[model samples]
Each structure stands twice: as C-alpha cells, then as structure tokens.
Target: MKTMKTLLSASLALTALSGCQPETEKPNILFLLVDDMQSDAIAALGNKNVYTPNIDGLIAEGVTFTRTYTNGALCGALSMPSRAMLMTGRGVFEVQSDGMKIPECMVTLPEQLRANGYQTFATGKWHSDHASFNRSFAAGENIFFGGMHPYEKNGHCSPRLYHYDRTGQYKETSFIGEEFSSKMFADAAIEFLSTAAKAQNPFMAFVSFTSPHDPRNQLPDYGKKYKAKDIILPTNFLPQHPFDNGELAIRDEQILPPPRTGEQLQEELALYYGMVSEVDEQIGRVLNALNATGEREHTVIVFASDNGLAMGQNGLLGKQSLYEHSVGVPMLIIDPRSKKHGFKTDALCYLYDLYPTLCDIVGIEIPASVTGVSLKPLLEGTTDKLRDDIFLAYSNQQRALVKDDYKYIIYNVEGKITEQLFNLKKDPKEMANLADAMPQKAAAYKEMLIQRLKEQQDFCNIDTPLWWKDGHKITWDELINLYIFE
Candidate 1:
C-alpha cells in the first residue's frame, strides 16, 4: 500500500474526478423559549397593544406559524407538559409527565443532537426534571428548574438554580437573584454563545425565559411606560366566566377573582405587556451577542413559547382552558442562509412538531420515537400545509375540535355535559353559540369531535349520550336546566 499522505491525496483526486464535493458546514441552532406568550401578544404579529421589538425582529426575519398550539390537555402544571411535548415530540395523551418530570421517551431533541456530534448548551428555565435536563444538555448554566420565578410583593425573590452537572446529580443549587430572571438567562446565553464560537463542532443553544408569565414584577420601570387606562379589553372579556368548566379554583384564576374590576384587568394587561417587552429587550441582548460571534452566519433561530395564556379572554384568566386564547402559541423559524423571510403559514400544528422540524433543519435523522410531523416542507417552500383540522382538550372536562374556522366544544363538568359550536370566521369572538339554532351542523361537529377525541385517546367516556342523533344531549336534567336558562 502507498504512504498515508499519498493514499489521502489519491482518494481526494478520485473523489473530485467522481464529481463529488466536500460537505458544507452544518448550521448552528438557537432555540428561544418564552413562557405564557399568546399567539397575538407580539406587536409584529398584529397585536397593536404590545411592545416586543426584539421578538418582532425575529418575526420580520423568519417564517411564522400562525396557528401553532400546545398539546391542548395536560395534567399537573401546564408548562411542564408543554415543554415535555416539545422536547419529546409527542402529544399530551402520548407522553406521561408526573411531578414535572419528563416521561419515558426514547429520545429528546437535544439528546438526539448531542448524540449526532452536536454540542448543546441550555440556560434559564427548564421545568422538566433534573435528570432529563442533565441528559438533554452537554453543559448549562443559570439553569432554573422551577415552575415560576419566586416572587415577592416588591419584586422577584431569591430563586434557586443549578450549573451543569456531568454526573446528572445536580445536587448543588444557587439562589441567584442579584439580576432579574430574563437578564440572567440572556447573560448565560451570551456566555454560552461566546464559548460556542470557539468550539469547532456545531452547537445548539436553548435559552428559555420565565418572564411574562406570572409575577410580572421584574422590571418596574418597563411597567411604568404603559398606562392602565390605555389597555384595551378583549371583546370576549367578562366579569365572570360564563360557567365553571372546571379549574376555576386554580391559582391562575385566583390571580384576580370574579367581578374583575375594569381597573384591575387594565392594570394586569399593562403590567403583562411591560413584562413581555422586558423579556424582549433581554432577548435582543442575546441576539446582539449572537451577531457579534462568527457562528451567526450559519445559525438558525427558533422562537416559540411553551403555551398561551388568557389574561382576560374568554371570561377566563388562566391557561387551563381550551379556548383559542389559552391554547394558541407564537412560533417562528429563522434561517439566516435562506432567502425566505417574513413569511407566515396558517397550517395548524402543535408545539411537539419542533423535534422533527429541527432535525430536518439540521440534516439529522429524526428518530422513530418522535411522533410529530416535520414542517420542513412548509419551511422550505415545498408545501404550505401540514394539517387540516386541530384537536384540543382540558383534562377530561373539555374537548374541542376545529376545522375550517368552525369550532366545536364539549364540556363534561362532573358529568353534567354541555356543548358549544361557533362559526369562527363570522364570530371570531365566539359571541354566539349555534348549538341549538343549527342542530344539524352541531350534530355533525359533535360527531366529528367525538371521533377526534377517540383518535386523540381522550379519557372522557362518550357512551352516555341518550338521544343526540342530529340533535342535543338529552341529559337527566337538561330540560330543567334549559327551562331555568329560559
């Protein structure tokens, strides 16, 4: 055999002769996750009431998925399941989260990338368990493993966090409160990006911010920029929820009680907008750091929120409901090398789909364990749609299905079942319920919802209907309840 150098030269010559070229550098990935951000909360996304310049910039330079949502129904805390679904690439009924621990999935997005020659760094809030977080990231700092940042009346309290642990023990924790949460996470992100720039291997940085969630007291100065009286109320805002679809007793609803004063809701909206703007500023800092690095050329940015929140929409103030305000989330995928920018697709999709979508973006093989369908076609201009209809549930209490801008909702509060249907195109506010007026359409949608619920593995039983053939549920006392309403 020839010498090693001669052999390499000969191999290269043969490769060139065969019309083969060297592989291009794989792109770096930056996944930015926000907490409790609704689809319409961003100023760039047509929310005139908010000020999110940095996030708006991402929207300007990326393709937005206008109809992205969470897994719809989850038990325990909402954030945990939403993030779990994102990482594992599975639906709500598919994954099992207990005590905020990630379910037993075959692979996580970061873990898969790490196995495939990518160095992964994570910062900020990771509501999943320590073991999962440790396995997911190659290294991390300022890792907040809690639900929400600890809050005091004045501002944020000392919150516990952890540095990366190679052994996955994560035993030691630090109470870091010197800086606000969003700034702390952005600081960690900038540091990680700096290190990533020096590394030869392609890297992934996940910066998750717990801002704009609850305890919106971090940046008092930002909150001061907005007037409470100027905040506009949602068309569906009501002093009280029309009915207890269950979960009215949760802490989210208790943030402000029933008969919500106009001043109270306005103040809430103002502070919430300010909180989002604060997070947006911190995010801008992180983006500036990225641009300063050489790694910016081939990096792809994925901006998304875990789930949406209802500040005062649908007569509710929490995320535990299955209404549009509660389920829909903002999503954007920014590829720097691509010419496609500021595009949007209303093709419905869920948060879990990011796993396959990211894999497709990075040229990695999506594992068999991932159940989410990739949006690579949509991103690459090969297709504009992936889903025709969507399904949502809130525990076993509420189940909903939407197709072609028409929505059907079924409420099973303690087995006292009720139904609602709305032609969303005409009444986007859901001001009218056509369940009784259009019995035929309601019956059709109810059947469709049941079929979807079965396909989604809903826990609620559907055999209790007495006489709902092209009509309404003949409940044990529905007639009396109807008379009472009449």
Candidate 2:
C-alpha cells in the first residue's frame, strides 16, 4: 500500500509537470462576475421567488455549480486578494504587499491567455493592488471603482483606472452607476466583444458588476418591482444576533434595530431583492448581446460572486462571520463545447480553482505556482469528484475546513479561538452545533484545520503576522488610500 501511494504521488507530479490539454478548440471566454450576490438570490439556484430569468436562462444552457465557495466573506477582506489569486492562480499569500505592487514574478491568467493568442479585456471593480492589474490584462477599464466612491452617488462619472504593463497598454473609460453597474459593465464588454469578433480573435472579457452591495439602493424601476409589504422575511431572521460571536461592533449594528414585525423585515428584504433582480436583468442584456453577435455557441460563460451576503440570516445583514450564508457563494460555468450541461456537482471547489480550470478548459498550460487543481475532468463528466477536502481562511479572523458531510469552523477573535462543527448532510441550515457533543470528532477536525492552514502557508507563502492592529480604526478614505498604496 505504501509503495502504491508513493507511485501515485510520483505519477501526479509528472502529470502536473507535463500539463494537460482539452480535445476541443479553444473557446472565447466571457466572465460575468457580480459583487455581494448571495447564493440563494438566483432563481436557477433554487430561489423560487427571485426574478432572475436571464441568469436562469444561462443555467439552462450550462452547468450550475451547487457547492462553489469564495476565499473570503466580505468585500473589504477578500476582493483584492481573491482577484489576485484568480488572476495569478496563486493564493493571496503568494503575492507580496510592497507598496501597491503585485509580485512581478507571477504570471496572471490574462497574461498567459494573451501569450496563447488571446486578447483580454476587463471592466469594473479592479480592487487588487495596481501592480497586479497593470501587468495582468491586455486592456483595462473601471479598475478604480472599488475605492473611488461609497454607496451614495451611483458610481457614474468615476475616473477610469488603468495600468501600463508589459503585456499591453490599459486605457480608462467612463463608467456610471445610474443605470445599474451591471448594465454599464455589460455595455463595455459587448463593445469589446464586438471588436474582437470582427478581428476573429479568441478573447477573454471580464465583466464585473458592483451591485447588490450596501447603501441598499436600487434603481427606481427595480425597487418598484416588489412592494415592501410583499417581500418575504428569511426563516432565520433574528431580532439580534446572539452575543457578538466575535464580529465587529459596527457590522453587528447593521442588523440591529431588528425589524419589530414581519412587515419591517419584508421591507428590507424587498430592497435587497430589488438590487439582485436589477443585476439579473443586466445579465439578460449581456446574454442577448452575445447571441446577437452569433458568438454564444463559441463562448464559455462563467457566473459567480466575489462573496456571499447574510440577508437576515442569523440576524446579520453583512458578511463578517464564518457562517455558510456569509462565506458560501454561487458559481456557474457554461461551456458550449462540453456535454455536461444541466449537470450539478456536489464536490467541494473554491473560486481560486477557476484560474487553472479556465486554462484547462481552453487547452492552455497553468503555471507551477498555482495552488488550485483543474476542474476540467469534473466539468467534462469524466470524473465524479474534484477534491476530497476544501479549506477557507479569511482576514486572520475565521478559518474553516470542509469534507464530505462535515464542516468545522474556527473563529479567531481578539487573540482567542472558538470552534464549531456541523454535520452538513443532516443540517444544511447549520442550526445545530455538534461541537460539545462530540469531543473526539471536534479534536480530529481541529487537527485537520491546522494541517490545512499549514499547507496554505507552505504552498502560498502566507504569513501569520497580523497586518491590521486590533482596535485600530480608520476612515473610508484612509483605508482606500492605504490599500491603493499598500
């Protein structure tokens, strides 16, 4: 058995070095990324009441990921790092924070695709350090939208953020949030695709929408779709979250002043749903544009969110906890060349995996520094599983590891650690805590959690040092400047 295990490991190492390719011709890539979208907001993903026909149509045409996850729960915590990981195929730790530069040595996904004779274009929400964005893509737009404005004014008229890097030059374009950020991004993406189609070049277009985020504002038409009284409150709504559970005080207050009656709860949910529906409508428009260009069949479309939000779950409105509602996101990938349409996989997967997975699907070689495995086999219906275990870590505050039917979360707050375990198969809602009842199981999971963190450290060069001091408070502008210059 030992010898067989060693042989298998050696074979995997060789396979990794040799690289693998897909049988089909390389396909054009269209990435539809949304900000602060919850897992249950889309109709195709099991939300019966939400109006997401455009997104649902995409699901009907492609495979819907049932167990997709993001690197972090909050935009401020994971947006930049997660994006860096996606572009570089490396975890957040692999990239160093030297002023505002991403590690120059790392080759981003866009750069690799460009090298393979593909053109890349991106619009909206480049939250990562300027260094990463500059060196990564062929053309860039709206990268500065992340820290430029708060939820107040529609993000319209924001300056165009660009980076001049080795791959190519980046030019700024005008952006406005008046007509929903998703629609604006889609318009930019459609323009890029129209040009690419004319040139007959395989292209990658990343359309990022900054919507369904805070300030809870929505377009007047979308907001009018549902009356506040008609909205439905979440089943887990709580007047107040039990204790802090070690979450930030400011964030905790967002969910406070809890709705006194179901009507109040419904009012808040209506606004939230309104924001989601607005994004969905924009998605429809983008899909229609693709069809109109006659490139829908030749393109591979991927839909995913940066992170999940807690819309009244556990009395929480934001994503600052380790709960499933906060960290788990929806991911869908539709490849016209694959036969696995309408299939769902329960395998554990992370957003970081999309980088290598794309490389695999498009018949390109992934770099050696990438920590995620290719999901091509799973997508191709050749394999029933992807990974045996999935690990997640965020902001030095929460850590979690999940296996088949069990998940363990370790909450680290103010230098103290607390643990919780759940049998996901039995209680998907995670209402029951099995930690105290099963000491041996908890201990075993803890060991696995430690090993997972250690592996991430070794593979991604993640440092355990806390960059943000406890109790340190900074204004929004200051934080933005710090991130921009970091």
TM-score of each: 0.88, 0.82
Clashes of 1: 0
Candidate 2 lDDT over 37-108, as tens digits, reads 888888787775578888888788777777777655222444566566667666544544411245666777
lDDT of each: 0.76, 0.65
Q: Candidate 1 lDDT, tens digit per residue, 92-204?
A: 76665322556445588998887776767888888777788867876776778878865553344355666665677877656565577777778778877776666556778
Q: Candidate 2: global Cα-lDDT?
A: 0.65
Off by over 4 Å in 2: 1-25, 73-76, 97-101, 141-144, 147-149, 154-178, 220-224, 251-262, 415-417, 458-486
Winning model by lDDT? 1
Model 2 alpha-carbon miss at residue 339, Å: 1.5
Q: What CA RMSD would candidate 1 show?
A: 10.0
Off by over 4 Å in 1: 1-24, 152-157, 218-224, 465-486
TM-score of 1: 0.88
